[model samples]
Target: MSPFDQHQPAAKPLTVLIVAYLFPPLAGGGIPRVQKLVKYLNRMGVHTIVLTVEPPPGMVEDPTLLNDIPAHTPISRVPLPRWMNAFLGLWRRRSESESGKQDGTHSVDAKLHETAQEHGQARSLNMKQGQTDQRNTVFRKGPQKLKQSVQKIVGHALNWLRARIFVPDDEVVWVRGAVRAGMRVIERYPVDLIFSSSGPLSNHLVARSLKRKTHLPWVADFRDPWTENMHRTSIRWRLALEKRMEKSVFEEADAITTVTESFAQDFKRLYPARDVHVIYNGFDPEDFMELEGSPPNAPLTFAYTGILYGKRHPRYFFQALKRLIDDGMIRPDDVRLEVAGVLDYPGRSENRDALIALGLETVVRDHGFLPHREALALLKTSHVLVVFGDQEATAGRYIPGKLFEYMAIGRPILGLLKPGEASRIIEQFALGVHADPSDVDEIEEALRHIVTLYRSGALLKDIAHCSSKDRLSANERLCANERLSADERFTSEACLALEDRLRRFRRDVQAEAFYALFQSVVGAKQR
Candidate 1:
C-alpha cells in the first residue's frame, strides 16, 4: 500500500496548539511570527488554538493582528499575576547566573562617550588623510579600567535579578498552563499535536511537559537560537542547563524548525543527532495589495521597524546620517530616520539619551511600538527600509523578519550590518546596499549613494525591475512554509508514538525495580 493509503481518511481537521509568551496582544517580533503562523495555519486546513498571556498594563494589543485569527479559532488567555512575573524574573536571572551564563552587565556610559570622541576624531582623519594633527588629535584617552570592572560586576548582578528571579519563566508558565489546558481539551476532544515557537526559552519546557503527559508529538519552532543568540552571553552552568533543556526538547520533539538556515546549522551543531529544518518568514501578498500611497513628509524618510538590540544599534545609523548631514553629503531637509518598535529594557533610556546627545533628537523620531500593519504602511511610504544585522554573530544566522517584508515593499534597503547572511540576501535580490555598522564612513558612503540616486531620480528606474523580481514566488513561499509544516507533521506523529511507548516502558521498569527492592527489604526484616 502507498504511504497515503496506509493512513485512515482525515477525521476532524488537524489541531495545532500554539504556546507562546508574546502573542497577538503583546507587541514584539515574536508576535508577528505567531500571528502569521496562526493565520496561515487556518488557511492550510489546520485549526489553531492559541495559548498566551493577557497584555500587561501599558502594553497595547494590536486589533489588526487579532482580527486575522479565524473566528472559529479558540484562544485561551491566562492572565499572569504581576507579582508572579516579578518573582519569575528574579528567579530566571539568578538561574542564569547560577548556570554560569552572563545575566547582566553595567551600562558603559563612559565608554560610550569615549567611543564617540574617538569616532569623531576618526572622521576628521578620514576627511584629511595627510593631516597628522587631526589623526593624532582623534586618538584620545580610553575609559578607566576600574570603572569598567565595577560596571561589569553591577550589570551582571542586575541582569541576574531581571532575567531570573523577577521574570518568571514565561515559557514555563505558559507551557504548564497549556499542557494542563491542552490535556483537558484533548480528553474531551481529540487533537493531533502541540506546536510552539520561542525566544523566551520557557516554551520548550511547556512543550516538553505536555509531550510527557499526552504522548502527542511536538514541533518546536525557533525564531532565534537559544544559546547562540548574540544578544545573550552564555555562562557555562546556564549553557549546560540550556543545552540539556534544548537537547531534551530536540530529542523529544517530532521536528525542530527555525527561521534562518544559519540558525538551523547552529542548532544542528548543538543537537547533531536531531533533525532541524529552516523556514524563511514570508509575507501575505494580499495584505500589501491595497497599498496606500506614501504620505507627504518633509525629509526623505528612512524607517526601521523592529527591536533594536546591542549588535543592531540605532547609534551607528544615526551617527552615520549625522556625519553625512554635517559634511553636506545630504541636507537636513533631505533626510530623516524613524525608528518604530520597543527598545528592550536596560539600554533603552541610555540609547535615547545618546541619540539626543548626538544632536539627532529632531532628525530621528521614535514612534515606539506601532502595530505591525501600521509599520508596514509606514514602510510603503518611505524611500528606504533600514535593515540591521547583529554585529556579534555571523550575518545570516538570524535574518530579521522585517527584511522579507521590506523586500515585498519594493523600497531601496539601506542595510546597517556586517558582511553576513543578510548582506548576501540583499545582494542576491539586488534589493539594496549594505555597510559595516561600526564604520561611519562606509555608512556615509551607502547613504550618499542612495541620496545621489534619489536626487537624480534614477533609483526607481534602476531598482524597479529588480524590486519586481524580489517579490516572493508562490513556489518559493510554499517551499519555505513546507519546511516548518513538514517538520511539524513529522514531529507531532513521532512524539505521539514515542510518548506512548516511553511512558509504559518507564512504568514497567519502575515497577520491576520497586518489586526487587521490596523483596530485599522483606528478607532483611524476616532475618
Candidate 2:
C-alpha cells in the first residue's frame, strides 16, 4: 500500500533479538531509527523481539511512535531500579514532612515553593498577572542561581563519581535486568540473530554477554562512536577500559554496522579482519505521506526540530539573526524562527535563556517537544530548516538522524555544520547552505545570503511543493534543479538526485541489507 511496500518475494523469516536502550514511548532522535528498523525488518520477513528500558527521567514519550511498530512484535522493557534512581536522578519529595529538603546544595521546585510561601510572598500561579510578574522577578532566578552555583561547584566531582560509577553510562545499571529478560525470550524461541544498537554503550554491553553465552551470530550497531564521542566526559582510565571492551565486541561481532561511512571505516581499521557495514541514518518516508502539504502565502520560517543543548546549541544563529536585523539585511517580523524540542542542559534552561538574552523571544517560537506527527507537520510547512552540530574532532563522522527527515520534506535547509559528512551530503544534494557553527560572523554572512534568496522567492521554487498524495510522484520535481545554472543554487534537478540517494538509506532497504547480513553470518540461507 506504500511506495516502498510492493510486490516482492519476502526473505525467509528469522527471529531477531534486538537489544536497544532507547525505543518508542521514550522520545529522542534514536527512538525513531530503531522503531523504523523494526517496522521494515518485519516487512522484509524478519520477526523481531525488542528489549529496551522503561521510560527514564527527562524524556518526552510519544506513544504515537508505537503506532509505527508492527503488530505482534514483542517488546520487553526493564525498569530502572529504585536505588539507581535515588543515586543518579535529582531528589523527589515523599511528603510535606520533608519540606525544604536539600539534595546536596540544590533544592527541588517543591522546596522552593514552600520557601516562597513561608516568606508571605504571593505565589505566581495563584496571583494576578502583575503580581505573578512581581513574584517571577523576585524569586525565579535566585533559587535557580543557587542551584546552578551548587551544580557548578560539584560538576567535576560528579563527573569523577560518574567515571567511578556509570563506567559505560548511567544506563549500565539496566543491563543486567535487560539480559535476564532477553534470556527468557532466547529460551522460549530460537533467536537466529542478535542485534544491538547504541549511543549509550550499555546496550552493546548487554548484547555482548548474551552473544557470549548463547553463541548466536550477533550484529553490533553503533549509532555513534564510543571512545571517540564528543557528547560526554571521557575519563582516561574509563576510556582505556572501554576501548578494551570495544575491542572485545568488535572482535566477536560477526557483522558491525554504523550510521556514518567514516565511522565504519574507522572501525574497519580498528578490526581489519571483521566486516563493517555503512547504514546511513535516514527518514521513514511513509510517516509524511498522510500529512497535508504546505499551503501558499506562508511566512518565511526556519525550524530546528530536535534537542539542542550544551555544545550543540545554536547561539550563533541567534547572534546572526540579531545582526541581520540591525544591518537591515532581514526583517524581524517577516521571518520567524521555530524550535520544536527540549533545550535544557543539566540544572538550567540554557537554550531558553539564550533566546530571551538576545531579545528574539517575540520572533522565535519555542514549541517545546511536540509529538512526532505534529513536529513533522510543522517541519513540512517551513521555508528553511536548521541542522546544527558542535565543533569536535569526531564531528565530521556525526551525521544527525534528523537531516534526512529535513531532506524528505523537500524544503531548503540551512545547516550549521563543519565540512563533514552531513555538510558534504547537503552540498552534494544542493539541499541548502552551510556555515561553521562556531563562527558567528560566518553564520551571519550565510544568514544574509539565504534571506536574500528568500526575499527573491528562489528557495521555495526548488522544493517540490505538492499535495500529500502527490509526494511520491513529485520526486520528478527535484529533477529540474539539476539542469539549472550555477546561479540557481538549489535547482529541481539536484533535489531529485538527493531524493534518489535518500532511497538507499530508507528503513526497508537498510533493514533488508541487515537481514541479509544476519542470514549470511548465521549461514541460515544455505541451511
Candidate 3:
C-alpha cells in the first residue's frame, strides 16, 4: 500500500504559537488573513496559541470571529502602553522634520546656536548632560566632524532617556511580556511550533526571543516585505541597519512563508540558501454562498474594499468611469462605485476633495470601514469587484489579501494593475478582466466590454466557458487513476483467462494444418 493509503488519517495535531501585533478588533487588511489562517489551521488539526495585543480603542470586539478556533485554543493578550505608542509617533514625526531641516535650511552656525542654547539650559536647570531639554533639542548641529561627535554623544544620551521613558524594554518588550505569559502556558501544556506573523514585524522579534529560550522551531510569516516594503522610506543612515535586521530574521527563521509567489521568490533571492514557501491567501468557501443563487443585479454595482493608500491609487478607475459618463457611454444613474474602507491616514481628514476633483464625488459612495463579514456580504451584492494595485515597485509583487476573498465571491473581477503577478493570478483563475492603468483607452475598452456583455446577456455564459483547461486536466487525472485501479483488480481476479483460450486455439489450428500437409505430400509422391 502507498504511504498515503496506509495513513488514512492525519497524525497528532501540530501546536502553533501565533505572534501578531494586530488581531481582531483591529480593523485592517492583515486581520482577516490572520484570522482565517488560525481558524483554518484549527480545522486542519493544528492547535493555535495566539499572542496579540488587546484591540486598540475605537475598534469593535467580535468574539464570534474566534469561534473557528478550537474551544481550548490558547489566547494571550498583551497590553500596549498607549502613552508610549503615542510618544513614539510624536518623536518619529519630530525626527523626520528635524532630519529634513538639517538637509535644507538649517546652517551649521544656526545649528551651533541651537546646541549652545540647549546645553546652557541643561546647565541652568542643574540637569545632567543627557537630561531633558524642554525645547526638544534633537537637531542642534549640522553634519560636521566635530559637530557630529558632540551630536552623537548627546543623541546617545537622549536615546537612553527615550528608551527608558517610551520603550523601556526596547523592541523585544512585547515579546518579553508574551514570553513570560507563554512560559506559564508552555509549562502546563505542550507547544510543538512557534508561528509568527508580522507587519509591525515586531512579532518576529518576539518569536525570535522565544525561540532562543525554548529552542522551538519557528515559522515567520511575512504579509509584506520587511525593510524593503515600498511604503517604508527611512533615512539613508538607518536603511542599512534596517536591512541587516530584516536579514537576521530571515536567517534565523526555520521556515519562511509569504502570501504571494512573487514575494516568496524575492525572499529566496535575499537569502539564496533558504527555503521559502508561497501560500497564497485563500477564502472561506462560505463567502460565496450568496453568489450561488443570486442573479446579477441591474446598474452593475462595483465595489472596492480596504485601504487605498500610497501608490495604490484609484485614479485610473475614476478617470475611465468619468470618461464613460462624459462621452455618454454609460449613464451616471446606471452605475455606482462603492468604496468601503478607511480613507486617508488615521486622524487625518478625508479625501473627499480629491475625489471631487476627479469628478467621482457623486458617483462613488464611501462606506468607510465595515466589519469583515459585513464587507463580504456587501461583496456578494455587487456585480463586479475592483482589484486595484499600485504602479510602484511593490505593485504586483504582493497580492492583496482581498484578492482571495474577492475570488471567493465568484463575481467577475476588474483588475487595474500593471501586467504582473496579480494579473497572472486573475487570468489563471479565469476570475475577471485586466487593463493597464496607464492606458485610459484600454481601461475604457475593458469597461465597455463588460457593459456590452451585460446588455447582450452573454456575460454569465462567457465566464462559465472561458476556462475548461483546469477542469479537463482534473478529469484526465481521475480517468488515469480509475484505469490504474481497474488494471490492478483484473490482474488479481482472472490473470490466466486470456492465456488459456489462446493456447487451446493455437493447438487446434496446428493439428489441422499438419494433417493437410501430410495428405498433400503423399498424393504428390504417388503421382
Candidate 4:
C-alpha cells in the first residue's frame, strides 16, 4: 500500500474529477486553494483528476503551482476556444469605443471616427504601464457638459451590453469543452464524484451537464458566492439569472461546499435540503520556507498582495496614511504601502487617482499583479500585511484568504475593512487592528495602532518565534474573522480553540475535511 493510503481509513481510494476552471499553469488567488486541496486530498488517499482549461490570455503564467499538486495527479487541459477570446477582445473594443464620449464638441461624426480608431487599436492590445489611463484620458479630455451627457448615454449602453451578453461571465465558452474533458476523465478513471469549483461558475454548469449524463454525485464548490458578491454590479435582473443558475447547480449537486461558513450558511438558507459544508481556502505551508532574513535599509512596509478593485480598493488605507502624515503619527518616509496587484481587472490602476489626490504618490507603490510566489515573498519583507475589504452588505460574509496568508506570515496585520470578520479576526488573534474602509478618523486610529505595533516589533518577534507551527495555535484566537462568528458552527471560542488546538489551517488539513466529505458521498468502507 502507498504511504498516503495509510493516512485514510478508506478500504479503497475514492477517485474524483475536480472540474476547476482555474488551476495550475494559470495563476490567480482562486488557483492555489483548489490546487492545494487536490494535493492534500490525493495524499489522503483520494484519487484526484483535475480538469481545467488552457491558460487564458492575460492570465499570469506561473508553472510552480503545479509542483504542489500530487505528482501523479492527472490534469486534463481543455483548450479555450479562440473565438471566445476573440469575442472578449471585442468586449474590450466595445468599451474603448463607447466608454467616454464626454465632450459634446467631439461631435457624433468625430465620435464615430474615434470609435473606429479605438476598435482598431483594441484588436491586439499589449499590457504596458499607463496604457489604460492613456486610453481613458483621451475621451475624458472633452467638454464638461457634453462630456457628462455623452458619458451617461455611453456608460448605460455599455453596461447593458455587458449585462445582456456576458450572462454569468466570459468563461461561458469553457463549459462545453470542460464537460467533454470531464466525460473523458470519467471514462479513464473510476471517478465516483464530480467536483466542480467555480468563479467562472461555468465549472458547475459543466458539472451540471455531466451529472445529468452520468448520474454521478456532483459536489459544487463556490469559492466566492455568485449573486451575494458586493463587488459585482448589483443588478436585480443579472442576479435573478445568476441565482437561477446557482439554484440549478444546487439542485444537481449532491453536496455543496464553500470557502467560509458564512457562505455555507447562505447556501443552506437558499437550499435547505442541500448538504452545504464549509471547506475553507487555506495556505500550503511548504510554499513558505525560511522567509528572507530582515534586511538593512528596509522601511516599515505595509504590503497588500491580491486583486484590488471595487469595494476592496485601498483608498481608505491611503487616506488613513495621509491623515497620519498630517498628524505626525508616522513619518511619510517611514511608511511604504506596496500593493502587489493591479487596482482593477483590466490592469487599470483606478486607485491611482485616490493615491494622487491624497498626495501619497510617493509613499504608495502599485506593483501590478506579481506572480503568486513573488507576491508572498514581497509580503514577507513588510512590517505588516494589509488587508482591505469594505462593509458593503454582501462583502461582510467571509474572511479573505489573505488573512490566512498573513497569519502564516506571522506579521502584525492592519485591516481597512468594515466591522466584519476581517476586523474581528484582527482583534481576536492580536493579528492587527481594523478601520472602516471609508472613514478617515477610524482609519487614522487604526493606522496609529499599527504604526505603534511596527515600532514595538512584537509581531516580528512573534513570527520569528512561530518557527514550526503552520499558523497561529491555541493561545492565538484561531485568527478567523468576525464573519466566522455568524456561522452557527463557529459560535463559541471552545469550538474555535478545538479547531485550531492541534494544528492550523494548512491545505492538508483543509483537504482532509474535504476528503471526509468525499468519502461520505461515495459510502466507501473504512479500513
Q: Evaluated with TM-score, which candidate comes out highest?
A: 2
Model 1 worst lDDT run, 10 consecutive residues: 106-115
- Tens-digit lDDT track of model 2 for 421-526: 9999888777788988888988988888888888787767755432233555324333333335567554555555555755665766777667666766777533
CA lDDT of each prediction against the hidden true structure: 0.57, 0.68, 0.56, 0.64
Model with the higher TM-score, candidate 2 or 4: 2
Q: After superposition, how far is residue 198 of candidate 1 from its true place, in Å?
A: 1.1
> Could you tell me the lDDT of residue 487 within candidate 2?
73
lDDT value, candidate 2, whole model: 0.68
TM-scores for all candidates: the values are 0.72, 0.83, 0.68, 0.79
Model 4's alpha-carbon lDDT is 0.64
- lDDT by residue for model 4 (155-193), tens: 456556555566676567778888888888888888888
Residue-level lDDT for 286 in candidate 2: 80
The Cα error of candidate 4 at residue 31, in Å, is: 0.9
Total backbone clashes of model 1? 37
Query: How do the residues 47-100 of candidate 3 rate in per-residue lDDT, one tens digit apiece?
Result: 678888765433334444565556777788887567644543443322321221
lDDT winner between 1 and 2, please give it.
2
lDDT of 1 by residue, 296-377 (tens): 3346778887656555666777777778788877775566666665332321244565656666545555455555666777
Q: Per TM-score, what order, best first?
A: 2, 4, 1, 3
- lDDT accuracy of residue 351 in candidate 1: 55
Error of 4 at 255 (Å): 0.8
